[model samples]
Target: MRILVTGGAGFIGSALVRRLIAHTDHEVLVYDKLTYAGVLSSLEPVASSNRYSFVQADVCDAEAVAKALREFKPDVVAHLAAESHVDRSIDGPGEFIQTNMVGTFVMLNQALGYWRGLDEAAKARFRFHHISTDEVFGSLGEEGFFTETTPYDPRSPYSASKAGSDHLVRAWGHTYGLPVLVTNCSNNYGPYHFPEKLIPLIIIRALNGEPLPVYGDGSNVRDWLFVDDHARALQAVFETGTPGETYNVGGNAERKNIEVVTAICSILDRLRPKAEGKYADQITYVTDRPGHDHRYAIDASKIRADLGWTPSVTFEEGIERTVVWYLENQAWWQAILDARYATQRLGVA
Candidate 1:
């Protein structure tokens, strides 16, 4: 299949592209704007593959995205492009609204037009897969998990924009007969992850003996899904999922914010112990994020039962592998940090 993946240089998009190029016969084209967090270096692994190609452009550019779609004639369009950092969204929401909301509108309209012009068979086989986040469901109190049916109550600009996109995808499917599928996934931690996010940020700070910042009292909980697991699930949904339907993908690995930091510290303490003290010694709590959700856990049972899929890695195992990946692949991540983008606190203007 010829697949066009937007935001292919970003964290999850790059990971998905690597999996497609390495494991499948599909031809993948990466469409990215190369924002500060979107690193072409992340897409370097698949650079040499004949099945992989890339274009530097913004998703909001209707003509560019349309031109690519018309030329590539993709069998599938996986839309992963967006400004995803919540804190960054807090600091500068205009970019998030532009990229996530307006960009999706342009892509959906362009894709609908392209799909209408395809051959009957190609139209039947074509798909527009929209990737989303569980944060759109808002903060959970003490119990319950976010299922495919959960109500969207986005608190931050990041999630609000995403929620708008999700609605657009579904509305396009319902109103215009676009073959669209949406997946809201949990926290993803693995290799090639930009350091601005939680896992990599904690890992790097621990390595440098810098303080590991914990928001609030660190009791906020999250369901952590490994990137590879989420990628595979996305493949399944795109291939066999019912258009207009939504699926929740998760690792079922729920852990408190503090527990996650502490686990990272413990792993580093054993694998790359410092001379002074444990990595946990650097823990520092600051002001909590505005509208920070108390917890986000995905009820991925629909995807599990429907597609026969589930995450294979335990949180402990996933974190261990992730730590080792950073340890061994310093060139990949260090270049990211020393480059114009550092893991310095974002969204805290």
Candidate 2:
């Protein structure tokens, strides 16, 4: 099958593209805007392969998207393009609204038009899979988990925009009979993740012996999913998932913010310890994010039962592997840190 995947240079997207190119017989065309977090190096493994291609265009550009659709004539359109950083969204919301909301609107319309032009059998096999986040379900209480049926209660600008996009995808499927599948996933950590996110940021800062900043006592909790697991879940859904259905993908690995940071510190202590004191000595508490949700936990039973998919790695194993990857592959991330973003944060001053 021929697949068109947007945001295929970002962490999870690149993982998916590599899996498709290496493991499956599908031809993949990556449509990515190549923002600060989106690095070409992430897709380097599959770039030399005949099955993978890339487009340097924005999802909001109707002309570019429409042209790509017509030329690629994809059997599956995997939508993963968006303004993904929550803190960045807090700093500058206009871009998130434009990309996550309006961008999705444009992509949906273009995909619908392309789907209508396909022949009968080809049209029946076509799929539009929208990748989303569990953050759109807002903060969780002490118990209970977010399921596919969870209501939208986004607190931050990023989550709100993603929620809007998810609604639009469902509306297009219900209103126009478009064959669409939406999956809302938890936090993903793995190789090629941008330094802006918590896991990578801590690892890089720890390596440099810089102060490791923790937010507001760092008790905020989130379910952690490995990026590779998410990519596999996406492929499973794109291939066999029923149209107009929603799935929740999670690692079932929930950890508090402080625990996540501390765990990284422990891993670095073993792998790349400081000369003098322990890595945890560098920990510092900072102000919390504005409008930050308290917690997010995912109920992945639906996908597990239906798709027969579960997280393949324990958070400990995944984090250790990720740390080793960063330790050994300094060149890949250094280029991104030096050229694209200087490791200074934008959303926080």
Candidate 3:
């Protein structure tokens, strides 16, 4: 099978691409805009494979997307391109609206057209999978987890835009008969992650002996999913999932903001011990971002029961491996920092 993955150079997207190239027989073509977070280096491991290829293009460009679809003739289109950082979205929301909402519209339209032109057999086999986030379900209180049926209460521009895209995909499926699948996944962390989000940011700052900023009272919670496990779940959904259905994927691991930072410090204390003190010593509280969700957890029982999928790596195991990756691959991340892209790119500051 031939699969086209948008935003395939970014953290989770790159992990999915590498998984397809390394573990499966399918041919993969990565379509990425090379945004600040979309590092081509992340895809280096599988770039040389005969089954792997890449085309630098924006998802919002209709002609480019159409041309790529015609050329690649993919059996599946995995849409992962978007402005994903909530902090950046808070600072500037226009990009998130444009890329996540408008870009998805363009992709869905192009996909519908392409699907219509396919042979009946090919059309029957084609799938358009839209990747989304659990943030769209909004902040959970002290209680329940987000299910596929949860009402959307997006608080930030990033989640709002993603919520729009999720609707577009389902709308296309219902109104136009496009075979589309959507997955709202929990926070993903692993190697090749850009250092803007929580886990990577903490790892990078801890290594630099800089202050690790925790928002508010540092009590917000998130269900963390390993990227590789999420990638596998993606493949399963695209291959066998029912059209117009939504799946909630999660790690079943929940941790508070302060707990995560403290855990990272504990890992680093053993791996890259600093002479001064523990990494946790650098913790500093900062003003919480506007509309910061208090908690996000996914009830992945549906996916577990129906698809027989579950995250293999525990949070402790995943975090340990993640810390080890960042430590050993300083060249990969340091290059990003040296280029000043970490601070300057994507309206990060």
Looking at model 3, residue 328 earns an lDDT score of 95
Question: What are the per-residue Cα lDDT tens digits for candidate 3 across 1-349?
Answer: 9999999999999999999998999999999999877899999999789999999999999999999999999999999999999999988899999999999999999999999999999999999999999999999998999999999999999999999999999999999999999999999999998988899999999898899999999999999999999999999999888888899999999999899999999999998899987889999999988888999999999988888889999999999999999999999999988766556665654
TM-score of each: 0.97, 0.97, 0.98
Displacement of the residue 179 alpha carbon in candidate 1, Å: 0.7
Question: Least lDDT summed over 10 consecutive residues: which range in candidate 3?
Answer: 340-349
Q: Per TM-score, what order, best first?
A: 3, 2, 1
- The number of the candidate with the highest lDDT is 3
Error of 3 at 43 (Å): 0.5
lDDT for model 1 comes to 0.92
Candidate 3: clashing residue pairs, number: 0
Task: For residues 1-349, write the lDDT of model 1, one tens digit per residue.
Answer: 9999999998899989999998999999999999887888888899999999999999999999999999999999999999999999999899999999999999999999999999999999999999999989999988898988888999999999999999999999999999999999999999988898888999999898789999999999999999999999989999889888899999999999999999999999999989887899899998999988889998888998999999988898999999999999999888877664444455422
User: Which residue pairs collide in model 2, if any?
Assistant: none
Between candidates 2 and 3, the lDDT winner: 3
Ranked by lDDT, top first = 3, 2, 1
The alpha-carbon lDDT assigned to residue 334 of candidate 2 equals: 85
Q: Write the per-residue lDDT of candidate 2 for residues 1-349, one digit (tens) a residue.
A: 9999999998889999999999999999999998876899889899899889999999999999999999999999999999899999999999999999999999999999999999999999999999999999999988999988877899999999999999999999999999999999999999999988999999999999899999898999999988999999999999999999999999999999999999999999898878899989989999989987888899999888998999999999999999999999999978877775444555422
